[model samples]
Target: MNPDQFQKNSMYIETPEDGGKNFDDDGRAKRTGTWVTASAHIITAVIGSGVLSLAWAIAQMGWVAGPAVLFAFSFITYFTSTLLADCYRSPDPVHGKRNYTYSDVVRSVLGGRRFQLCGLAQYINLVGVTIGYTITASISMVAVKRSNCFHKHGHHDKCYTSNNPFMILFACIQIVLSQIPNFHKLSWLSIVAAIMSFAYSSIGLGLSIAKVAGGSGEHVRTTLTGVEVGVDVTGSEKVWRTFQAIGDIAFAYAFSNVLIEIQDTLKSGPPENKVMKRASLIGILTTTLFYVLCGLLGYAAFGNDAPGNFLTGFGFYEPFWLIDFANVCIAVHLVGAYQVFCQPIFGFVENWSKERWSNSQFVSGEHAVNLPLCGTYHVNFFRVVWRTTYVIITALIAMMFPFFNDFLGLIGSLSFWPLTVYFPIEMYIKQSKMQRFSFTWTWLKILSWACLIVSIISAAGSIQGLALDLKRYQPFKPQQ
Candidate 1:
């Protein structure tokens, strides 16, 4: 079924017209401009705050290697998107729902719960990744402000003036603003976010290119030799290989769940009405080029010791106006992207409530042990409590794991294997009703095996990275 029809059919009793299709709402299905759906996904996924560190990661692969990885990622991303579109075109007929849930998709493939196990694995993986992203973004913002904007040196007079306050404040703001749940309301924000993201990316690229053209070799040496640089991988070929692994990383960037949510955004029109293919292609190509530029520019600018937080490290000389512009862009960008990740969790909770409980029981609090409330029936009370608690939990998780860029890459490495690599092929086999594996299927099996192996290696590397970060950890410390 098309997106507009899905929205109309899939809504709940309370918010029937809202069409909680995992993504945004579609108020102007046939009448709205083409930019509505096309720009939303790009703004939400491609313009994430993670791009701030693209340069540093790319630099580890060297000047030439970094952009090459971006290109590879773009190609892989394009191919994967097509695969997803294909899957959508020929959905399993048995599953009446137009969209595929992780568990449902698995059930379609592996007969019973084997695929469900995979979906369960994905649940934990996505939760961790989402939490990690929130935390990492918080931390990066902190580092960016702390790098210079705060007190120049130790001063007794500086009270609530640290980066921590700003982080908390901004995160809280995001949580509150993100709570507003209407896609039609958010589309304008997405458009604005896209504009800001493109602008930030453009300026970031220009700066990188300008630095490259300045012809200062010694500065490169400084970047290479800097002891505290986050991207230091000068002599380590293994690290370079890790950098070369951006192809798979780029595929991870596709972030399928986000698309699943916004499925309703894709409206149908008359046969004469052209598909929004142009808008979609534009968004993809723009995002791909931006990644390429950022990767290349970052490596050239920072070399070995480049900061993991690219927005802060090389942004020392960013024009004031541009900085202000990027801040607004990033703020909206965060809102757009944050909703994509959060919507599934919300849907999960919402669906569970609907299936497992009657409206009267929920209103009357049939199970009060886990529930809390302030009024008669108190269902809404506990629902508020539930959402509030999640917000707090997500915030705390963010606080605990603040290494934004590194943690994101680690999550991508560890989880990408199972979720994107293994699950899709498995589902295609069982759900698509192909009795035997074809040549393409054989290649997919090989790819899955490779991904499985890489998942292992990357997990080890990630753990090591974590261990290094926690070197000072101890159950107890001797009294000073």
Candidate 2:
């Protein structure tokens, strides 16, 4: 019947009073996460490879508009994230039932009819995210390898350019990392991933500032060609550019797909609203600062000449070590980010399997594996096979669809509105039992409706842009 109220055993009924702890003493959570750990995962979820595109985004929007959009979205993201966090609560922890997955939250609030819609959106988001990450890792490895070759050869000689091999190699790394068992177990890896994100991002930002100061930027760049500061563009071009910039920031800031599950990893706490609100503030504020630096400096460094990805704009042996380090960090961060986003995907898949095969490796506390005294969660068969294969499939897509921007455009276009804008607003209103057509409800509805319409328009443009680019670039052809 009600999945949130699904009884794991006869004695365990989750309610608002019990704080969602089904067992009296969960050794798993005891050893798991603090608010710091939760913040680390949120950082991993919030700041990914997308920040690398901010300069290119700012280039499209101009200094004023770009940073304004980023700041606005950051505030909106924090607000919506808190709304999602509120949904994680119940009347009592054990008696009322808390939502662990976005789908579960939707199913509980809206009904089973709307649950699958949430599932479709989430599944697409994760699969697209995994593909996007694989592509990024492959490209980052290629960049790292090229920098190494430049250092060795003392010139800009072309090195190994095919990304498929690197994609496969990176898939091996994901294979190992994705098996960390469950969400809370990933807290450590998420911390490392967040560190690596700052590592590469800071390097990129520092490099951009240096280039801009050094006056190394060419007058004419690929994305910024024929464009100047202060929005001196035509009507159609402005609309197109604004939508493009919106897609970039929206996609870059997107963490809604993983927000609920990330909260699930929090140490059973004094209501997740406070903890998650704190974590969201930390993660989004830090990420916004980084985005502003990267976007603004990147535009300054190579005004009208900035590349779509900031790290790739450096040519030849110039600043070889720093560029190489940035690429390495990109690869490292992607490995962890992949698993962070994929956890809910894995959970969604395995839940069905666990239900179907109750006699198999479906683990409970009593039947848990004897892995360690410290941990309550078990290592099981389904975890090993399914997760490994999922990474492998994503790797294949990376190889096949090698265009980085196109896949990202598609992801941003498709999932941004549903995941980021619409669902949270609707869910909050319904869950809070707010009055219809009241001032707050009316304003939120308008905002969400505006978001949906813009998202649809942007998605259409992105699809067309991606299709035309694929037709023109045909990246799948073996690289020279």
Candidate 3:
């Protein structure tokens, strides 16, 4: 309860042989001490790309809502994360030794068969995020090229790829290069990437703010539209109502999976808990500060009617130099995306194979070989096939579904439902007998149900939006 007691409790120890396969000359010792650094890398990877979208999400919610939602979201995320970490301590651990994923928590709670169904839902959402981001980055790439500011400055072919061939080639290269075995070893690359993204974003935002400050003395009014109606539109109430929505924008920035990357890093248990907890706290706090500053500054600079792409919105009003900086920032941010999205596929493959072959027996490189990491002929001929497939699929979806705000909301409702809400509570209650569940446990149950219901509603909304788009693309079709 006290600080000293908390510290002691947090410093729980985990043995080397405790939670996994021993695959080196030194039985429990790690061959490469990359995970500590990788922890920071994973933080950058998880938090980097999607953050630029937060202000837009908040603006949609209403200006007043931004900071409130951001704070509330962070609080919920922090609480949920602590609960999840505790769940791992359950006496009857279901996912012992194996690195349990988000779906694994669902399986342990709801049982394996149910996990498959939940996994399907989760996959749909993950696929949406994957596709949406890929398309966003691709379009961003083209936009960077067309923007007069970046164009006038210099001409790097890699920096300006609008055609399909170059898009696929460039994206694939980034994805593959990111997957090199101990890519986590290159963790500092992520911190550098984050710093670059932050710097670039700051410069563009500052420029936009200066522009707005100099020439926006005149006031104007606009009619409220469908969603805009949610904000109090009365002349006196509108300003405060809009201000409240900033929290949701901030909330949109809290993604939690970065901590999972350290399954190998932290020794599993009570002893190493302090270091792990400290790391998570630091990562979350740093991320929250970054989001709040960027979101507030962005909305202040661009105003509520800003477009889906923050950089694009800034570019429209920014000086040429600032626009060029924005382009470079966006490009660097995409590299972070490559690291986050691509790593899972690579890890999945490596784990699949590592069980059968000794570390030395496993083959590597561009060539395909007979290993568990390699799938049967259909899916495993070349790693390029999978990477290319994801890029193409993502591109098509992005072009078709350009309502990125709605897409991200759906992603949050679906993926975060099982991942951050339901699974943590369920795993703690169901798996760990040592973990006590009080009558207030009903609160978590209620939260889980709310998350599930919200996800279903959001999914329906996505379907409705897609249907409407289809009608627009083919207006002559019979009314269904």
lDDT agreement of model 2 with the native: 0.73
Comparing candidate 1 with candidate 3, which one achieves the higher TM-score? 1
- Supply candidate 2's per-residue lDDT for 282: 89
Candidate with the greatest TM-score versus the true structure: 2
The residue-by-residue lDDT of candidate 3 on 79-173, one tens digit each, is: 67666655432343423433234444455455666666655655454565665555556545555545563456543532333434434645665
lDDT of 1 by residue, 57-174 (tens): 6655555655665665555444444344334323543223344333433453354566556656666655665576565445434434433443343333222223344446655765
TM-score of each: 0.72, 0.80, 0.68
Per-residue lDDT tens digits for candidate 2, residues 1-480, read: 124323343235344355635432332223245678778777766777888777877877776777888898888788888877877755333334666667767777776656777778878887898898888888888887777777788665646467888888988988877776655565777678888988888888888878877775456342433255354556665566567667777788777877887787776556567788898888888778878888888888866555667787773457788798888888988887787678767775766666767677343212355556666645676777888999889888777677665567668767877887778887888878899999999999998888777677767656655665566664433221
Instruction: Count clashing pairs, candidate 2.
Output: 19
Flag clash pairs in model 1: 22-261, 23-261, 23-262, 25-183, 135-398, 136-404, 229-305
| Per-model lDDT | 0.52, 0.73, 0.52
Highest-scoring model, lDDT: 2
Give per-model CA RMSD: 7.5, 5.7, 9.5
Candidate 3 off by > 4 Å: 1-27, 30-46, 89-111, 114-126, 149-192, 208-254, 267-270, 346-386, 432-438, 461-480
